[model samples]
Target: MALKKKKSKKMTSTGTDVNITSLMDVLTVLLFFLIKSATVSSLELTPPKGMKLPTAEMKEEPKEAIKIALSKDMLVVDEKTMVKLDAGRFPASYLMEDGRTIKPLKEFLVQEYQKKKDFYKDVADENVDLLPPPTLLIQADHKLPFGTLKHLLHTAAISGFADYQFVVETPGE
Candidate 1:
């Protein structure tokens, strides 16, 4: 006698769903890391108004110093206006009669030096006989003339700020 064939059972699958929650978490962590790295790698300091800094291939970070910003129409020291240029010319109040020394600028530098000396003395908690040399940071416009910068440097040297660092913008990658 022929026996009835046993009923066969078939199994079917609708589809497969992928789990991406872990992937999303990893991506979020990576994004945050990149943002933090970008912010920490760069220093932020606004240049004077109407000033365009020159680009350089050098990659040295600037240290804290007395900032001197020179634009076409203004000369700022530590964000204070020491002189104003009139039609690309320095006024008499800014320069001496000999035209070799910047009177106001020198005075400002001297005052700053005295203040720094006092700060050093206070920090040492003793009467310091000799203080460290002053550090000057120059942020000049790219369009500024060499003669003007030279004169400014001369004034700084005479005012006891012999060490100088020129602040330039880094070139774009």
Candidate 2:
């Protein structure tokens, strides 16, 4: 029997490298989408110092309004210092002698109304006879006294801010 020469097989190597550039591009797009959606769904409101917001069951979304923030030590209107609380008391500069109407607050509201009216007048159509009423948003601490809130509402009504809304926190499910 003739012995056949043994044939040696050449060794061939198979590479196992993985391409991750496409996967990285997809993950980057997903991250961007999540960040954009989170910002769009969240409300932008900052409570003042020492203020804990009240919780409510209401589902209505708040509209644009002049924000009035009330904390234990200060009262801010649209980020402007309206009154400084002294020893847990409302400032005398804002309160009238009768202690019923908040004069300074009313005056500020009237000035704001005038400014908005002028702006609207310049931008509104001549055929429009009346403009929509302005809205006011009150952000009061949960521990705030009822009497203080009552006075604030009364003052706001007198200042022609009949459309008012209270800012509160909604309990999470």
Candidate 3:
């Protein structure tokens, strides 16, 4: 009897097939982390001290603003007054060359109004009507009474400056 030869079975590897689900999960997690890392910050600006401003009923704020100053015995605009600042007694020598120096509060406000009006005409864009009105910020010492501020406001109104903003300290420290 001849010996029978047994054939061995050949083992072949299966073709490479990658599972895309795992890769897609990793990509999605990376995308989520990248988006979460990004951030934005907001900023706000505040005015200086001793310049506490009065509030208005309107919620929206204006773009253009002007500042005026009030002092004892005299009114000044933007901290600059025609009359000189002194502890006591008004000086005679401090006078403008035009001879018509600022002696009254109304005159000072009127002068400022005229200047602003002319300036608005020169720089204002012609295309836009009802342009932003210039806001007048009046800063008066706490000691000063409301009468002075009222006069200043009246003067501004007369000179076509209808918009007004009062600068004052908040009540109660």
Using lDDT, give the best candidate's number. Answer: 1
- Lowest summed lDDT window (length 10), candidate 3: 39-48
| Per-prediction TM-score | 0.73, 0.73, 0.41
Please list all clashing residue pairs in model 1, or write none if there are none: none
Clash count list over all predictions: 0, 0, 0
lDDT of candidate 3 over 30-103, digit per residue (tens): 99987886434331223334433554344333334556665554445555554533442234343234322433
Query: In candidate 3, how many Å is residue 105 off?
Result: 6.0
Cα RMSD for candidate 2? 6.1
lDDT scores of the candidates, listed in order: 0.82, 0.79, 0.54
Task: Name the weakest run of 10 consecutive residues (lDDT summed) in model 1.
Answer: 36-45
Clashes of 3: 0
Q: In terms of TM-score, how similar is model 3 to the real structure?
A: 0.41
Candidate 3's error at 14, in angstroms?
58
Off by over 4 Å in 2: 1-14, 17-43, 126-129
Cα lDDT over the full model 1:
0.82
